[model samples]
Target: MERKEYYAVIFTSKRTDGDNGYGKMAERMEELAGQQPGFIGIESARDANLGITVSYWESLEAIKHWKENSAHQTAQKLGKSSWYEDYFVRICKVERDYGMNE
Candidate 1:
């Protein structure tokens, strides 16, 4: 069967200096996101100061809800104030995808 269209939230970031609780918060955020409705999956990678996390969602409304989540909001504030030097978030509609395992 063909997969339906979905949304991917691509979050790219540059770290400030040290962990300072970032690792714990990131783990918590991932756990919370998995519990949310319409969450598909997530992938993340980091090297030195740069990081990229791509979270899949069923729709735009789902993404909006995730953004409004209180814990996630707190994390965002913390990212700006403490952990991240800079970041970018891009939402893309995925109409088709191909992978080796599939």
Candidate 2:
């Protein structure tokens, strides 16, 4: 499919310690986000104590909805209280992009 203007939410974080249900929560969040409106796609990578997840959206409103989701709110609270040691979120507009064809 041809792509157009969109938004990317970049979430970068350093984990606290053990699993503590983080792995399961992360998987659940991904699954839930996929079912939300205007969700485009998501990409993630983790190395040792650090992780990066980029979720694509059709608009900022859609992003806001995802942020306000009750389940997501729970995850956010857990992230702050137990999961993440530190984190940063960056939202950017994708004006243009190009990549090799598969």
For residues 1-101, write the lDDT of model 1, one tens digit per residue: 45799999999999999889999999999999999999999999999978999999999999999999999999999999999889999999999988877
lDDT of 1 at 29: 99
- Residue 82, model 2: lDDT of 99
Candidate 2 residues 1-102, lDDT tens each?
A: 458999999999999989999999999999999999999999999999789999999999999999999999999999999999999999999998777872
The Cα local distance difference test for each model comes to: 0.96, 0.96
lDDT assessment of candidate 2: 0.96
In angstroms, how far off is 27's CA in candidate 2? 0.6
Cα misplacement distance, residue 98 of candidate 1 (Å): 1.2
Pick out the ten consecutive residues of candidate 2 with the lowest summed lDDT.
93-102
Q: What is the lDDT of residue 41 in candidate 2?
A: 93
Q: Clashes in model 1: which pairs? A: none
